[model samples]
Target: MNGYRFYTAASLLLLTALFTACQKSAPAPQEESGVNAETEIIPEPNAGSEKPQLTVAISVDIAPYVMKNATTGIEVDIATQALPGYQLNFIQLPYEKLQSAVAQDQADMALGVQKFKDVEGIFYSENFIDFVNAAITKKSANLKIEKVADLADHKVLTWQDAYLELGPEFEKLFAPDSPQRKNYVEVADQSEQVQQFWDAKDVVIVIDRSIFNAISQAKGHKLSEVDYASIFPEATYFKANFEEADVRDAFNAGLKKLCSSGEYAKLLKKYNIELPNTICDSKAHP
Candidate 1:
């Protein structure tokens, strides 16, 4: 009986020691990873609210900005990083359809929109990037576009809906009743616009500055041989219209965070996109 009691006490002591050791051996909670912490999300709108997945509308087939083959682009990267809490649903469509997606309540935000002026039930976040536009001509043509009116005498090729996207001033200049409308052609494909310009079908092609540079580099256009008329002012791109104001506000907050954290610069580097002076200027205050 005494031996049995001794064994029981010894076993209890052993169990106690094991419990104490386990308490000491267990790991404390580890700090969140830098990337995870950096991307730490704020819950959507109201607490305990179950928000539907966010739909982000982007124009399809816009390379480097909205890639045709790849799932990611500059705007996609920014959106993904900025809105970490919501399950992003990208609805890729044509330029016109993209805006309609938001209007029809089919999308939460429209990516890469220049402006939403005069659009009802639509709001836009702070401008995140600038779309520098220009008029390009072949060296042989020597066509000069000193201003919007200068393009009246020359055949001009530009992306679809450019008249509306370029702002009210451009709208008036490219109005249906305006004589410039006779020579004005809005193409659906940017590649075709660049090709048409290179083929010398038009006197001038209106395109985004960075896009023109990329196409020019690929086609082996000599920098000295091509003239880019810096006529149009830069257009500011923004996240336009979400179902809820809080959602848009959250994105604005996240965008500011992204800019301040230098993640915006990193994204531009990753995509090989040149940082425009407009964006660079925004970084100063961010």
Candidate 2:
């Protein structure tokens, strides 16, 4: 009778041990978060992403074009989209400092660089952006401006350097030597230009459409009541200047790719910007 009781107790102990062992050896319950799943592959942050940093110089004055935020706007975005292989770090300086920064090696590249006659020691990329200048007038004015010459009939307002920029025909007509030169005013401040245009209903402003819209709309001006005439040629191309020729070539290639893939147009619309002329409009390779 004692052996039988002892055997019963021993069997119970053995069975409990076996049950605990089985439970311990069983596969872990599936995690609700799926972290332990066999198929889940989570990438480590910054894994194998050792891209070189490219310091780009940009204008601080041009709002909506410069560094509007930490990682957006026309100048910052254009460089970011154009150079995917390298990380871009933009240094916002004044308009005059853009070229000097690159020239002095303060930045690796500069946006909105133009190849001036006397400017040297810079590698310019293919014409990447067009400023899209136009002859703006009031919609109710009924102005017939099919060409640059027609602007002679009305008061013209333009940027300070418009004479050298708006082609020889414009230079001949309104830039200089016109008896109406007093009526054709060129001011350095474009914000003033927009104000002046709206202040005088008959005034025709020679300005970039995007810039005009940017300034005008910000000042609570209604665009539906405005009219623009694109008389200027799309020759003035915007380029990125680089310290190295190789980098310039790389940027050109990337720009071409963006245009081909149609991402360039999408970016333009994202910023509510457009090309001055219909010739390329961020589509052409050149």
Candidate 3:
């Protein structure tokens, strides 16, 4: 009986030793490798920072201001020079539809918007471009236009939406309700308007001085041959209307810099236009 007990104890000791050896010799759970096998997303260098893009509504397409390509001209040159930091995305609209773009929130700002009337949500920038408008005629016509009322007696030609732009007095004389409406003609193309005057097809054409000068001079016609009736004496201004005040303020600051640096004059000369009145000289305050 004693010998049987001794044999059982020896067998138990051998089994315990074999289990201990197997645990120590095992691969030790691979030491975890410290590497993450799951997929990870690495961020790009400039993932969130990007240039600001401004969607601009440009309606002025007249010669010297805006060209047929909708990209080159005085307006474009001025915009580029003034706002060098922004990426301007220009969307060409008609003159009549300029303010509607900002009113409807279709664009951030409307460039060259003629301030005929005030829109509700739009904020105007400083008077950027001075558009000298007048009644042009061949010197031989000998037409005397002392005021806007004198245009009622003759067949008058002007740019699109001129009745609204001229004044309430002019609108009263030649608006849709006036009998003289039949005699008043509105031309979409100022170039064509100037050509009609030179061609003797139209006796009186009201147009911007710069545009008329640019077009008439381009046609090899001398300014001496024509008489520009300075009936509209006020310097009409075109402005940029914005939906946001900050953006408008920024544009004003930029415009002030452009004017102060003498870059504005260079742009005007490059476009073959010497505007009569400008904010450049007095814009140092801005």
Candidate 4:
């Protein structure tokens, strides 16, 4: 009778152990949290691991290069596409304020800045784009700008800081006490300058060919409507800043890749910008 009781207890113990093992190996019941047996729980990416943001300070509203529209411009796209690991931010500033903004650490870089004066704490990158500044006047005005000196007598309307930005020669010609300063109007508003040129026959506006073309098209004015008496040589421009040398280096590497990949050409073609075949000969700031 003792052996029979012990065998029965042993059999019950084995069955209970087997049942517990089966229950432990089975899947748990789904909860109200929406997690199912087949559900995949992917790890969320940390926001702190995102690319560092970089910034560009732009002075003028050069359409097709930099614009107020949602489509943006070629320069905007180029900067963003060139740097793979950077998030690009842009600060719109007046032409006169661009340099100061860069100087004061208001921005990381300033685009379209040319080398002229011996500026301290500012470093310029390799020339990325060239601008052809045209001296424009209405065909009916019969304005002749064979040389820079001819601008001395006219009521010339130019973008702000044109006196300093153009070159040392332009600086001398448009100096405060120079005869040109009497008639030279430094307009901060580019659209107003264009409009004033149309309204006043005596005013001559200096603008980039690409930008003028973009603006003219927007205003329903044909290219034939205006005359470019004299256009400046291709002026190479560089990005300027104090502390973002590494960013500039990365940009150059990306730019070289862009050119070799044929993407740069495609971008220029898309914006109807004339392709510059030669890189600027000098890196010393033109």
Q: Which number leads on lDDT?
A: 3
Worst 10 residues of 1 by lDDT: 277-286
- Per-residue lDDT of 11-86 in model 1, one digit per residue for the tens? 9999999999999999997877665556867666875575458878877755567665327877788887888888
lDDT of each: 0.74, 0.77, 0.80, 0.74
Clashing pairs in 2: 132-276
- Least lDDT summed over 10 consecutive residues: which range in candidate 3? 30-39
135-211, model 4: which lDDT tens digit per residue? Answer: 88888888888777778788888887777656666678889888668988987867667777777866678877787
- lDDT, residue 153, model 4: 81
lDDT for predicted candidate 1 compared with the true structure: 0.74
| 2 or 4, greater by lDDT | 2
- Using all chains and alpha carbons, the TM-scores for the candidates as numbered come to 0.73, 0.67, 0.76, 0.79
By TM-score, the better pick of 3 and 4 is: 4
Clashes in candidate 4: how many? 0
